[model samples]
Target: MHIGKAIRLERIFDRNTKRAIIVPMDHGVSVGPIDGIVNMKEAVGKVVEGGANAVVEHKGLVRCGHRAEGKDIGLIVHLSASTSLSPFPNAKCLVASVEDAIRLGADAVSIHVNLGDETERRMLHDMGKVASDAANWGMPLLAMVYARGPKVKSEFDPETVAHCARVGTELGADVVKVPYTGDKASFEHVCDSCCIPVVIAGGPKLDSTEAFLRMVHDSLEAGGAGLSVGRNVFQHENPTRLVQSLNMIVHEDASVAEALAHLNG
Candidate 1:
């Protein structure tokens, strides 16, 4: 890795722990203004106050969320976008470039790719171009890879998720994010298949906080770098508390019970 890339990566991943608690606030592009992130500034503030390492958002919203004061957090500019209203919503398009993210003072850039989607080929082509540009500019790239196509029988299948992880690494992402394989053993295989840091994506919001915490715990046990969770963190009744709980789990290696206690207490 280039020194510049490493330095920028340190902003998002803890230097000592080498892990991250990233809250994605970029969902507004895909799903419209969701509940937690309707007020971008407030949502960003809540996560930063609770010790999130970074927040992922699209280029347009950077100014809305950027803070000159208060606890500092890394900014990751998401380059790809797709609207939920689209007939093929899984087909993501690159709306920003590495140069654009740098101009926005981003610590990193991210792209989303649906591996089995009908538009997967185009997405992969764009990803390759982004990876090349990121490398040239010495910017770290995080790939949010998913298997959400017609042929995908199970998005969380260990083998399928492992392929997703590898696709990111093979395409030159610094960190890869994929859905967890539902257990430590299966998830471990997903982690082991990728050379770069593997982070688990928090899918939909779960019914219980304990289940969420437990999933984080299990993913970490299976050698995940951390989490790129959004809805579960930002939509919670206490967003800060939830992020703090995740921080404990990802950075301090706290037990699920202990992390839950921190959230509740």
Candidate 2:
């Protein structure tokens, strides 16, 4: 790996654990300014305070969230977007570049690609180009890969998730994020097949905090590198506490019960 890329990746992934607890705040572009991220700086601060390794946001929002004080957190500039208001919401298009991320002082860059979509081909093309540019610049790339189209019955299907992860790895992503397949065994298979670091995505908010923590714990047990959860963390009643719990589970190897104790304490 390029020395620069390796150094940048360490900012995102904990050096000791080789895992990450990433909070994606790029939803403002996809779903408008939702709860938990209306004030980007505050949202970023909460996660940083809770010891999150990184936070992902779009290029435009970088100014809104950049911190001049407090503990430093890795910044990952998201390079692709598709608004929910659009008819083809699944079709993500490149809205920024690796160079844009670099200019913004981002520690890494990320792109989203929805496989099985009608415009999957175009998204793949864009990802390929961005991957090349990122390599040339020695910028770490995180690929958010998902299976969301007519043919896909369930995005969380283990095989489909594995395929999504493999797609990210094949296209040169240093880290790949995919929806967790429901159980440890299935998700283990997904992680085993991908060579690069595989992180789970926090899908729609779950029923309870325990359920959310359980999912993260299970994924890590299944060989997952960590997570790139959004709503579940930022939208939680206590975003800081939630992220603290996540850090314990992801980096400290704390059990779900122990992490829950920390969260509630």
Candidate 3:
């Protein structure tokens, strides 16, 4: 790893634990101002207060949520965008650049790619370009890789998830985010195949905090680096508490029950 990349990664990952609790706030570009994040600054404060390592968002929203006081969190500029209203929502396009992210004071930059989309070829091309630019700039790139296509029978299939993670690593991503394969045995296979750090996506919001924490615990047991969870953390009744629980599991090696206890206590 480049010295510059390592320095930047230190801002995102716990130095002692080598894990991260990242809150992805870039969903507005895809789903629009949903609850829990309509007030970006407040939501960001909650994340920081809970000891989250980083938060990911588009370039425009960076200043909106950045704090002038308090412990700072890592800022990752998301480079892709595709609205839910679009007929081809899976067709993510490069809406920003590594240079743009640098100008925005980003610690890292991220891109999204759906491997099985009809526009997969185009997205892959864009991802390569971004990876190249990121390399030139000595910036870390987080790839949100998913197996979403007409032919895909199950998005959470271990083999499919492994393919998605490897695609990110092959394209030069420093970190890859993919759906959890539902079990530790299967998920461990996905982690083993990827050279870069692999983080699990939050997917849809879950019914309970304990349930969400258990998923995080299971993923960590499968050898995942950490989490890039979004809705599940931000939409919880107490976003700060939820992030605290996540931090416990991801960085402190806390069990699911212990994390849930911290949330409830």
Candidate 4:
């Protein structure tokens, strides 16, 4: 691996703790102007202040200077795009190149792949090509895999999510971001089968902070590296407060109750 790629991976991989707190700001490309990220600077600041290890964002977000805005955190740029407004929302397009990501001073780059759809073959081809280019540059690759084909079970299915993880690693994703199955016993099969570090995605925000914390706790118990959460922290009335509580659970090993206590602390 190139020195640039190695250093980038180390920054987010958290070898010391074997975990990370990543805030994914790439949602704008997929869902368009969602909560919290409307004011990108404030959102980025909230996570950085709360001790997030990295922020995953699209080229537009990166160009907004969130990384420089939060000097301490690593920036992983997403090279894919598939907007809700598109005719085919599942057909991810390669919008940014690895070269552009490197030029923009990104620490790493990410790709999105959704399996079991008519668009599956195109996405896999794009991912494999992007990964090959990224590897040539020695850039670390983060794969956001979702099982969304005609045959996909519910998004929460453990078996489907496990396949997502396995396929991503087999195709060369350095880190795989996936949904957390409610039970550790089921998700363990996911973590155990994939060789690369696995991170859990915070899906649509839950109604209660406690619910969010419970998911985070369960993911860690299942051997997840950390989280790539969006609305749960950013959409909250107090992003700083929410991130503070989440940071306790992610990096400090605080239980859900203890972390919730820090919400107001």
Q: TM-score for each prediction?
A: 0.99, 0.99, 0.99, 0.95
Candidate 2 local lDDT, 123-198, one digit each (tens): 9999999999999999999999999999999999999999999999999999999998999999999999988999
Show the colliding residue pairs in model 3.
Answer: none
lDDT per model vs. reference: 0.94, 0.94, 0.93, 0.85
Clashing residue pairs in candidate 4 are 116-149
Q: Which segments of model 4 are wrong by more than 4 Å? A: 1-3, 67-71
| Tens-digit per-residue lDDT, 62-117, candidate 1 | 99987778989999999999999999899999999999999999999999999989
**Which pairs clash in model 2?**
none
Put down candidate 3 lDDT per residue, 26-112, tens digits, no spaces. Answer: 999899999989999999999999999999999999989987999899999999999999999999999999999999899999999
Q: Write the per-residue lDDT of candidate 4 for residues 1-265, one digit (tens) a residue.
A: 5787778888886777778888888888778888788877777887778777888888777756454544578889899888888878988879999998888888889999989878999999999998899899899999999988678768779888999999899998889999998888998899999988899998888898888899888888889988888777778888777877877887788899998888867
Lowest-sum lDDT 10-residue window in model 4: 62-71
